[model samples]
Target: MRHLSPGELIDAAEGHAAARATAHTEACEACRRQVASLREALAALRDVPDDEPSPLAWDLLAARIGRAVREAGAPKPWWAAWGWRFAPLLMVAVLAATAGVGVTLWHQRAASGSAASAGAVPGADEALAQDADGDERAAEDPSWSLVSDLSAGISLDDAADVGGLPPLGGSERALWQLSSDERRTLASILEAELAESAAAAPIIPGV
Candidate 1:
């Protein structure tokens, strides 16, 4: 016959075994010894009183529990984890928005200043428009038409005479004798001076 299990021995020792287990313990010497040992151990445990903690031990336990509960290990919100993932993108977007606002404000200020300047000067826009048109026309026509009053003493034929003019100055003759590279460099310098003068000159509406 197989030996009685620990559960069967426990049940027999506690007076709660089935009839078969009780009969097995009765017939088996080893099962009877096991049941007796288990009964004695259970009786010894029952004799001992339940332990209650001392006041200091209770206080220490409570403090340890409180420390754990009040600890600074606060978990981050659900969005906080995702925020780090997009931090660079968020920063870039913020910078782009700031730059856009700055540029828009700068343009608005520039336009307001231009409007104020135009308002302070009467016919300023018209004068500028006229000057631009005159420059375009001058560029298209290389020839200058003589005014009757300005050319009072000279005929059209005499105006065309090259010998009537004064001889070239030292600087003028030197410019005419410049090599191709030197001429290009000199032309660039003259163009720069002309541009500076044109920028500095004030526009007169009728002139």
Candidate 2:
């Protein structure tokens, strides 16, 4: 059997060694005696009291602790202020709300203008029906004759004639013939009427 080293004997004496070392030390007189002598010397050293610190040491320690506490309690820098931290977020929110309101107003104005224009147009429903009929006819016959007839101008005998060019009555007939304002007005009226019809149509369910 090998004898335990001084380090192992000291660890066993301090209750930190394995059980086998403890049992071997208990059964071995020489190892047990050496361990007891080391323990007694340590016990004697532990009985000595530590020396007291000088008066200046206590003052220095108190001042250091006070400075540490004061630094910890001081106010933060301007960059860490609450206003600076939240300003960007507030700006983004305000801009988003403004954009949303602007978009809503634009759409509302467009809708109102469309409604007013529709109210001004005469025979809008008839025009729409005629247009639909014309589209169907054109689709069925690629070589349509409607464009050629319009280009040739209408005759007084024709059903679609405007009664001999408004009877050549003063400047009003000339003004009516030369002015494109009527076409613009008619277009505005048609746009309004279409917008109204679209609004009145039944909504389809689901997205």
Candidate 3:
């Protein structure tokens, strides 16, 4: 049978696998190794403590807050504040700013989509490839393309000729030159393979 995957091993390590899987893992040496690795990782995670704030830290924070309260001058009435009177104006200004930003973004998006549909804009992939090429040239480091003219100067006709090569060219080239003894050995090997396959799956008939 095939070995258990990492996720299956993790579940086994955690003692969360089904009965059948657990049985198989118990017998399988490969799965035992996988489970051991996963358990080691789990152990490492378990060793890291969940950090909590100390009481001394809380006390220091409370002391700072109490000192700030004591130092503040005379308290004023909440309703008499200028901020309360201008609250509506502040809200109107914020809303206007948000609406202006939304409208600008929407118009820009519409323009971009129209340009894309008209095929006026270069594709994302094309732009990325161009940018990469530009960066490579600017860096002045010889790229795979520059170091090997293996592909650089190849014309379309040359490419087509290469692509259209006979798939069995090597076999065809060697087939015609084989000696009689070499042909006999190849035939014997084929016969042996066929015999083994047939013997392994012999037909059984019943009355």
Best by lDDT: 1
lDDT of 1 by residue, 1-207 (tens): 877888888889999999899888889999999999999999999999979778699889999988997794675653454445435544544444454334434544455467668785323233233223333442342221222122245453442332332221224234334554554454456546856998878798455
lDDT of 3 by residue, 53-136 (tens): 887988999999888988975555543343344345334434444543344345444554776899886333332232233323
How well does model 3 score by local distance difference test? 0.54
lDDT head-to-head 1 vs 2, winner: 1
**Against the hidden reference, what TM-scores do the models get?**
0.31, 0.28, 0.28
Compared with the true structure, what per-residue lDDT tens digits does model 2 show for residues 29-133?
998888888888888988997887998999999999999989878766543443343445334434444543344345445655675688843443333332333
lDDT of each structure? Answer: 0.55, 0.54, 0.54
Candidate number with greatest TM-score: 1
Worst 10 residues of 2 by lDDT: 159-168
Answer with 1 or 3, whichever has the higher TM-score.
Answer: 1
Clashes of each: 0, 2, 0
lDDT of 3 at 52: 75
Which regions of candidate 2 deviate over 4 angstroms? 54-56, 61-207
RMSD per model, one decimal? 36.6, 32.0, 33.8
**Model 1: colliding residue pairs:** none
After superposing candidate 3 on the true structure, give the runs of residues whose Cα lies further than 4 Å from its correct spot.
Answer: 56-207
* lDDT score of residue 126 within candidate 2: 32
Question: Local error of candidate 1 at 98, Å?
Answer: 32
Q: What lDDT is obtained when candidate 1 is compared to the true structure?
A: 0.55
